[model samples]
Target: MSKKNKKHEPHEEHNDESWLLPYSDLMTLLLALFIVLYGMSTLDAKKFEELSQAFNAALTGGVSVLDQSTINGKTKNTPTKEQDNQNTSTLTAQNMTQLQKRNELRKQEEEDLEKLKKQLDQYIKQSGLTSQLATKLNQSQLLITISDNALFPSGSALVKPEASALAKALSGMLQKFPDYEILISGHTDNVPIDNDQFASNWDLSFARARNFMEILLQNNKLDPKMFSPIGYGEYHPVADNNTEVGRAKNRRVEISIIRKYQDPDSQVTITP
Candidate 1:
């Protein structure tokens, strides 16, 4: 008598999905961290800022790391475009000011040299030395040319007794410009000469230059340290050696007052 056997029912299974939610979140955070590290490795500030904003919006929907005054605990100060342009303008103004000052100095130098040339021309005219002496002013120097007969005898390096007056006059004028460098150069004709006093034209020319330079130094006002003597021998002739008149012109001495400040844009006219 009793009841029938109770029917048996199987238990229902339920899968756990709570762990997958956290796993997906961990993967997204890892991807964001990697992107931030890669951006830090590059030097481009603009690109780094763009990456920071993107990650910030995707992760926190708030201010970026760069906006918080730091990235990876280090602050960066990037100069604005206006600041760079201002620096460039300052440098350009400084350069223009320097150029204007230099041009003014050059103009004053030209006036001073021209005045000295006029004085020399007046003296030459009064002394009747136009045939023996000449003066020229150019960008590089103020040059004075003197014939060989004006300072030395034929083949002799000795300064003539009468030429002492000319040297004295030149030294007196040079005393006005004490800071200038003076070059006293001598030249000779191509004719070869072998004598007891000099073995070649080079020796004779150098001796003549030295003797003349010594006479100039006798004034004591001129600085001996500023003076230099050079001999070109038979080379660097201004005239042909084939003719007597040309050879006479070739055998000469030159005094050059070198310029202290040179203009790079100016054309240099070299005198023989």
Candidate 2:
């Protein structure tokens, strides 16, 4: 028996699943959104910013989403209010400690100056040089006054040959305060002076101050930078120029040691 001829059957049509591609992409975006939300909720500020940048790059084609939220067209990484307050408090505490230490050091400097003044006074008394020397301690400086005759001859700026011993003694005392600033100021009587060596009182006084400072700086240990010489030229007189005794007092040299603690805020200085 011959088989009957059969016609080819057509395949049945199924529903289209083309929408799944876009749907999957939407789901991926939703998942990224949830992750960013969770990161923000955790209050992890650093991690949140990192996640924001990552999602913005992945979802927005590398354009930053946080750029729209920027103030003054710049991103600010500002600390929270509580953190700022804590930092301020810590800084205030550090400043207070520094202030306290400065105050303590100032007190110690004053005490050292007082002790040095006493020692000098005792030396002057013992050496029988009290008539030629005097010491006074004030807020700004400790001044040592020496009669002109003690260091120089009449109308001469050169230090006396014997005064070298005195200079050495002073250097020994001053070595204890190596860091203190020293000022040697020279003053002359108002009498008109004209000599082959000096033209006027200004030249005489300046030469006297410089000569005295050179003697003090002869010690190898003393810092020459800490010393300065100034001349007052009979204008700055401690006594009247008209009298013989007053003129003698006016012609003197002053060695002033500056105080270490000079408070910028205070007008009153430590004195003894």
Candidate 3:
């Protein structure tokens, strides 16, 4: 074939790869969109933030919108100083109310005790037993002291026949204060006694208290569980043991009505 007449074969047409760039970009955008949709469906702010951070780091290496939104939400939810003050004020008011209620209850208890004391004093005066019997009201208790000679013979635990009336009257008065704890205590002089019925002052004193308490319990209105008996033999004396008069004062029985509500700050002692 002559050179001028030779046919040139057309180069194979290049594949149209120009469309590949846009197609790849479209695929990437679609993947990102699906990921965002899946994260939103979870409804977890923390997970969403982490996913946004990872995606942003991979794409542009910058902070994500999700992270900034979460931070702003936390700041807005934080309690303010004014709100804190309001909460403290509420607690203080509640505490003050409780304290006021306690104070009122204590005052009412004191008034009730005073009324009972006055009634007892009046009874003592009317019975002409002022010399042998004495009453004193203090913060801890209302004490009624009776000389041993009035209730029993010398160095004896048995109550005199005539003293029965006194026990009945006292029991009747005590019935009015049903909730009060009654303590019947016996005391003796320093002189010791050894006899057939009692081995020592301790035995005599305890027997005397028991006998007296039994008389008080004869009244059906008095609760036996509320009463207790104690013996202080030649001890816990209110007077000196050196003189006869002091010995007489030491040999006595005491009935104490203990207070139910006591003030922690106040201690009062009143002489009978």
Residue-level lDDT tens digits of model 2 in 192-235: 88678889998888889999999988998899999999888898
In the range 1-272, model 1's lDDT, one tens digit per residue, is 86589677988999998999999999989988887777787636666777788878878989865665554454556555677799899999999999899988888878878888898899899999999999999878899999999999899999999999999999988899888888888899999966798999998888888899999999998889999998889887898899999999999999988877776775433344
Cα lDDT computed for each candidate against the true fold: 0.85, 0.83, 0.84
Top-down lDDT ranking: 1, 3, 2
Give TM per candidate: 0.73, 0.74, 0.68
Worst 10 residues of 1 by lDDT: 263-272
Taking all chains together, the TM-score of candidate 3 against the true structure is: 0.68
- State the number of backbone clashes in model 1: 0
User: Every model's Cα RMSD, please?
Assistant: 6.3, 6.4, 8.3
Better of 2 and 3 by TM-score: 2
> Largest TM-score belongs to which candidate?
2
Angstrom error of the Cα, residue 87, model 1: value is: 2.0
